[model samples]
Target: MAEKKEQPDASKDEPEQIVDPWRVVTTSEKGVDYDKLIRQFGSERIDDAMLKRFEEVTGHKPHRFLRRGIFFSHRELKNILDLYEAKKPFFLYTGRGPSSSSMHVGHLIPFIFTKWLQDVFDVPLVVQMTDDEKFLWRELETPDVARNLAYENAKDIISCGFHRDKTFIFSNIDYISSCAAFYKNMLKVEKLVTFNQVRGIFGFNESDAIGKISFPAIQATPSFSNSFPEIFGEAADVPCLIPCAIDQDPYFRMTRDVAPKLNYLKPALIHSTFFPALQGAQTKMSASDKTSSIFLTDTQEEIKNKINRYAYSGGGSTEAEHREKGGDCDVDISYQYLTFFLEDDDRLAKIKEEYSSGRMMTGELKRELVVVLQSLIGDIQEKRRAVTDDIRRHFMTPRKLNHKA
Candidate 1:
């Protein structure tokens, strides 16, 4: 879920951008400067050559997210591709910190892309729901609240169409107790990572709880193949690829740094940009804020009302003025959302052209997005409704995933 951090003055030419696990904040209408972020994070850009290489190796077109540079930055992705090319085994790891009962549309980006990746690569995937992290961070009534939220969020993730045989979703609170290999890896990470190191990586201070200080190890454990003996057997050397939002890079950065010392393969990563809120690109959508985004549970009328009422418009004040001056798709929330959801490339391009040229009004552009989202969310709702407790349990169960490793 999105939270904004208080920052220095926005009047400056460059507002101080703050992106971390808990918050994503920027004052720019065009959102965070991802190129600057790529440099700051020391991650490589997913350039044209890389895309070409990916297509060549996988024999599948790069996902729309990759093609559009939505998942824009990466670390050691080529290593994973090379492993795939050589017919060696690798898996996927991604996670959610379950803070809310229902996840907003922004929460689906990684899972959607991960599903595509799973289909393309034919590999196993593990989704970690960090209920323990949420319990430490959030002011929930009890640990059970966070635990329940994890289960709820898993249904939404499962609704993204991950194959049951290829996907295993687990809650941190639940799995750490049951899996000895996972706990061993967590202990290994905790031992290698000092208090000073964690402070440097995660900005943990002496005032923070011991739980908060040590939680990075829990998140890092899934990156190692030996953590799940049922899935990968005793082969602790099998590397894994993590598909996650760039905000999560810090946890994995620490994991990667410690991998060699543990004699384990470093996890590879593919990073996605934050999905901007309906209110504007200046901040990400908050699951706690009903008006900030479209929730998976929102009705058709709510979707329409939210977009029409709250979606930040880049058009002129009046219809006549809009027609003359044109809308700015670059800053338009509706147009930005379409870039994520609308699948038809030609149609999206056409919409972009017409809207930016003043030929299309803000309402018209939003109407197009509303239809696309309603249908998309409608389909997801249908799928989510069919995801029973039993189905979710199967996805969460510790079993051998159906993949050649």
Candidate 2:
């Protein structure tokens, strides 16, 4: 079960997905669709052969989805990985501008990817819950929306298997007040960035708040270790590497620009493509639209129903036509989702073959994606149930850094 495809910019009214590809893609007639990616992203696109070279450069296989074009864009990812190989530890930072209650399954992408990086590198992690940001852009009340959503967001993020000893979660409301170093970093950034700079990078308006205008600095603070001096032992020199969805790159670009003046190491980053809505890749899925995404709280029946009713399919209208023409896995919703969640390379390969050649009907393919995602979310929900406000408070509090040196 999958939803029918809609116009590319369907989520135009949605907050985050309003802008089209921040960049572009390139397409060649002979091999690979470079044009679609450049058209979607911008003039810059990461092609398959380029990805193979990146893997060879790093000596790690590109994550399958990266290989599959689900994550078709990047900026300075190789540099970040190279730094890691040189034994330079870069802490991880990523954020959520909590705009809703219960997060949808798609929201977990960065957290899950980041958790892997943390374990692989064994470094400290700081997750920014940008509730203040939600208030700045949307009509939501600042205190009520931020405090409430921070609590709810902590639950969803904790469900992603982060280590309690190593992970720190902070809402802008809570952390900004407690950390002097954070504010200092914020001021340094504010000093370097002008209203003109933000306007050019983020398309911000002059009517926006000194708070909203200054908000990027709050997002930038965690990239410095001293933002949590208590946690990083007041180590201002240590740098962080952020792994985020590419839409978020503008903030860190500003951060990196000011790092030299601040005498801090510029943060390295690994950015991802936007996770397409259940409707399609042209727009991001919105929590406001029930049919646009699958929530973590969705029951098995709800999941099955959502997939059947809303997940977009590339399968042809008629079964005979589908068999004759074969499925286009390029925008195939089932295959697309599987690329994110399916870790088993062999089974994924089989599914791709069956799907693209039309050996498997869209319903059957959707069922596979449903099963894979249901298991993932079911496991996450069990962990989420164990998190309490007390645990959240402990994690949120600034504590002494457990420094090995």
Candidate 3:
């Protein structure tokens, strides 16, 4: 059953006032309020019934992210499932902003789940590197910085085990210039959305540059089939499913609003919660801050030290007090990281039980996480070493994927 919220008063002059959610600013001390965000974003919660529907349609058990509610909210995901049941073709679209050379662990959530979706559905997947977006948003000395970052980030994504024949990755700086359809779709979106609408959606102010104001269209263009005519023919009615963090919903919401106007399907979405920083749930991991997260390139010793020294513990200050009071699995950083990377459901549950009951000390809990993360990162680093420039070029080249149906 979808959780319903009271309808906002229609009489209000500004409907955006209906519910205060993440616009331009995202701030949460304890963690994001999923329930409040569901109401505010006008999306449905991914309830048990929906999960059952998903399994029945896919003929496979849902990924852990769904089972554990890591991906907690969605917009029109049921419609995508229905399409899948009918054996209709739909493509996967997910992206990264090229702001850094190395990706933190938090960056892997969507790609991990997206890879699973592609494996099951046997559909083509497109990964967009928004170098233009990074250029507009950040202070860079030259365009080369954004371009180099896009390639570097692509290497990390390529390390995620995406099927080369079935995956097509593109940098906006290159692809935007090469693809006319992309430009047309972007212009269509640019025309439909006004300056005020973008201001309302993205919290843009007069001080912001016009490039920033128009960048949403660049992101939005990928939602339509025409944007990648080589993969989906110019007139193809193929739709897209976007799996991303909830922070990105505002951009896609605008895309969905304009899709129908251009005679395209509104992109379906599955939203994941923010991967909290080592310190707490109030903020997300930053690539600029080396100490705040575990990067894909970190050594085993680096992972160990970061988890032991920096991972915020939820246990009491003293051993005796911890034994009496127990640890908080809810706010514990180590436990939260396990929920994302640790695949064994039973093991994770047991860890939670032991830690919460004070049977395990804080050092022991962090040690467990350290081991799990080190192994995961070590494997990725090994794979990333093999992703050569030629491989990167092949992935970046726009072409038809070897999709089965």
Best by lDDT: 1
Question: What are the per-model numbers of colliding residue pairs?
Answer: 0, 17, 0
Highest-scoring model, TM-score: 1
Off by over 4 Å in 3: 1-29
**What lDDT score belongs to each candidate, Candidate 1 first?**
0.91, 0.74, 0.86
The predicted structure with the larger lDDT, 1 or 3, is: 1
Q: How would the candidate models be sorted by TM-score, starting from the highest?
A: 1, 3, 2
Worst 10 residues of 1 by lDDT: 1-10
In what order do the candidates fall by lDDT, top score first?
Answer: 1, 3, 2
Consecutive 10-residue window with the lowest summed lDDT within model 2 = 23-32
TM-score of each: 0.96, 0.85, 0.94
Tell me the lDDT of candidate 2.
0.74
- Give candidate 2 misplaced runs (Cα > 4 Å): 1-83, 401-404
The residue-by-residue lDDT of candidate 3 on 295-392, one tens digit each, is: 99899999999998888888999999999999998889999999998999999999999999999999999989998999998988999999999999
What does candidate 3 score on TM? 0.94
Q: Cα miss at 376, model 1 (Å)?
A: 0.8
Residue clash pairs of candidate 1 = none
Output the lDDT of residue 314, model 1.
Answer: 96
Cα misplacement distance, residue 106 of candidate 1 (Å): 0.4
